[model samples]
Target chain A: MTISVLVVDDSPIARKMIRKALPADWDISIQEAGDGDEALAIYRSGGIDVIFLDLTMPRMDGFTLLEKLQQDDLNCFVIVVSADVQPGARERAMKLGAIEFVPKPIDPQALREVLREYGVMV
Target chain B: MSELLLNDDQTAALQEIANIGMGQAGNSLARIWGEFVALSVPRIATVAAARLPELIQRCVGDGRVSAARLLFHGAMRGEALVVISAADRRTLGSLMGFPAPAGDGDPGAQLLHIAETLAGACLGGIARQFEATIGFGAPALIGEDLPARAVVRADTLGVDLALCLEVRFRVEARSLAAHLVMLMPRQEVQGLAVLLDRFLCTL
Candidate 1:
């Protein structure tokens, strides 16, 4: 079984890091977006099961995207992976419907735990 | 110093690192001011003492501006400068608990305190990400509504070309805004590149 993942961030390096962090054993198909607008488009195109999002981006940031998703009742699970590690940030993301808030340069072990907790990986 | 250069990956990594740091800084500012803070994606480049010209242009271009500069040492060594316009300086001054009409208090001291809070949160956030500890020197008010180039203390400027990271923090729905400029000397650039590479490899 394969899970479709979308990694959204303005920094290519961040996207690369997220790609590297995903479990190697999981049958995951990954898509990348540079900002929220692009991620929304990709999600609308279907086949996305999970999203790793960054909050700060050039056009349409993660918070606004969350509002859009909530308004439309988008069903995909979103995990905010950002460098903005502030209590307020976590509160805001969770309030906006993010299932988890992972700090930037996410730890592989912690990421695995989240994936497993969500049953995205065994 | 021969011009220090960063490869594309190194540059991209630095930008992301700066973004994370600045986002946290913005959060700190917003909390204190009781407002939302907007952050610019950090711009990175290797600059010389010439950084002052651009900084002067940015802060003073709008109007009379003030600046406070601080030094940070330990795993990373460099200067952190906070530049704000006169109007924003007044706003930040009031936010820092300086009671009175913003104009009545010492704008210089106010800029220094604001700089400490801003530079501390910003550089502290970056240091944490680098897994390094950094210490700050007392921030000095380098200039206040001063004439061209005076805002930049020419004598205190470092001789080496610097890896300069620039980020802007603007308070939403208010005129309060600041520029946080961090200058990492060329001597530290190689070490920084190693650290960036280490981060890349660990991923």
Candidate 2:
């Protein structure tokens, strides 16, 4: 079965970059969401195996979305994509149940490693 | 209080400096999008934070407005930038070769990404020129009905003054337009002026 993915961010460029960074061989169907509300809607519809979420956004942020998804006990891997690498943001995201925290100005190699760890690709 | 405003010479200097910084940002964006981007002549204006609503309405008018907001924090300065209009976002997206959404999705995300990239490039360029270690938080989408206090707190702390600089741009090939508004604390503004003066003297 092909893995399904959801790319959630408020930036079109970020989503595009993440889309490009994904391995080409993976049989994945990518979907997009702009904010927490939209992401939640997609999650409720099911079939997604992985989520790439942004931290800062309008209407609802990634943190809140993570919280909600965890609260609902939804079964999907969430990897946070953020530029806020101050001090504790990463720890906080991991503690909140995000599988990984990826910094902005994304490095393709890093994304490959994360995807491999999540078993989204070999 | 009137001294907070830029004088003719200072205005001209700022125009030049901002143009240079924005040009650098445009080049970085162009490389990422693979298209040519041009910024309009800078415009200077002074207003209290309370006027932001009217400012947004007037500047954006009826045109669809999409914004990318970046917040900067530091001991020497604090700033907030709002990049406005959807057309500009679409142009940047097209340049990046993002396929149109095949399903229901937030189109705003693409714009936010472009805005974040632009903010990083502009800030990097400005910091390179000033030799300052500026910190940028992240970029987010600004709501049309953004609270005035949110923007006020973004630029000022208690009694500190905020210097607001507005930069507009037009993408000629796409016929799209956008604006970049930077809000820096008063002391940073003064420091920036001094730095600009020094740079000008050398030039």
Candidate 3:
């Protein structure tokens, strides 16, 4: 079985980093979204099992995206990859139903652990 | 430094917020470059609106510098900037995988992209500390000679008191360094102080 992942961020560099950090051995199909609008479109189309989201994007931000996901009852696991790592960031993301909060520059080991814990690895 | 604009508690709270924000920014940049980057503990101050220009001058000195700035408004209005020595432009460009400009000309486009991304990330991180909603305009370039005035007048109208936070960045095993400066309006500072006090009460 293949796991579908959506990586969303405005910066090309950041999106690239997140993609690079994914576990090589996993049967994962990756898709990219430069902003929340695009991410939402793809997400609404279904088949996304996990989302790597960034908070401060151009059009739609990660916070709004999280809210939308919850409103529509999307059951995918979300891991927030953001530079806005303030005191309340983790709590806020958790409140929005994110399974993990990883501050950027993305750490591969951390990414791997989160994937494993979430059962994203086959 | 003169009269102590913020008391010890306020200053400490702001510094802690800055530290968290900068640490997140450093981690983001490190991920992009696939390397570790270190960030300094941010130095924060609340200064009278009148003293802003002089304070900026002292920080930059008489060096050839360039800045990328973003103006934000909402619960509080202010700007965030990343300033770097002009000579370091090439190094930054190289680090980000942008080829050097033809000859020794300006560092355009690519540098602006980096600046905007970092500014949004760092400032957004800081604003979240107070649970304030801040909106940022597009990033604009401000030459060394003009950064102080540009920062002070980021709003559409006249000047206002400001909170300044300066954090330095040093990339691992690289000769590049940059300063991230955030200027928050006085009203925002007061609101943040109230929020911090309330936060302490909860603690």
Candidate maximizing TM-score: 1
- Pairs that collide in candidate 2 are A10-B109, A11-B109, A11-B110, A11-B113, A12-B109, A12-B110, B66-B85
lDDT of 1 by residue, A47-117 (tens): 89999999988889999999988987878899999877667778889999999999876787889999999
lDDT of 1 by residue, B1-203 (tens): 43656778888988987787787788787777777776777888776666656655664464677788999988778889888876677676557676665445766777777788888888887778789889999999877775535666545665646777888887767867788888877777788788888877865
Model 2 stretches with alpha carbons more than 4 Å out: A1-122, B1-3, B74-76, B87-92, B104-106, B144-161, B200-203
Model 1 residue runs over 4 Å out of place are: B1-4, B59-61, B101-103, B147-150, B153-160
Q: What is the TM-score of chain B in candidate 2?
A: 0.75
lDDT of 2 by residue, B1-203 (tens): 33455555566555544544565666666566554555444455655555554555565564556566777654225555655554455455556666667641455676667667666666565555556656788677665334333333423344334566665555567766556677665556666677666645643
Per-residue accuracy of model 2 over A1-119 as CA lDDT, tens digit each? 79899999765545776788787787899999988999999999998899998775667877789899989896999998765442345676788899988876467799889988877
The CA lDDT at A32 in model 1 is 96
User: Which structure among the candidates has the greatest DockQ?
Assistant: 1
Give the clashing pairs for model 3. A104-B27, A104-B28, A105-B27, A105-B28, A105-B31
Q: By lDDT, is 1 or 2 better? A: 1
lDDT of each: 0.81, 0.65, 0.71
DockQ of 3: 0.06
The CAPRI category of model 3 is: incorrect
True contacts kept of 1: 0.56
Write the number of the candidate with greater lDDT, choosing between 1 and 3.
1
lDDT of 3 by residue, B145-185 (tens): 34434443434425456778888766647756677778776
Error of 3 at B143 (Å): 2.3
Clashing pairs in 1: none
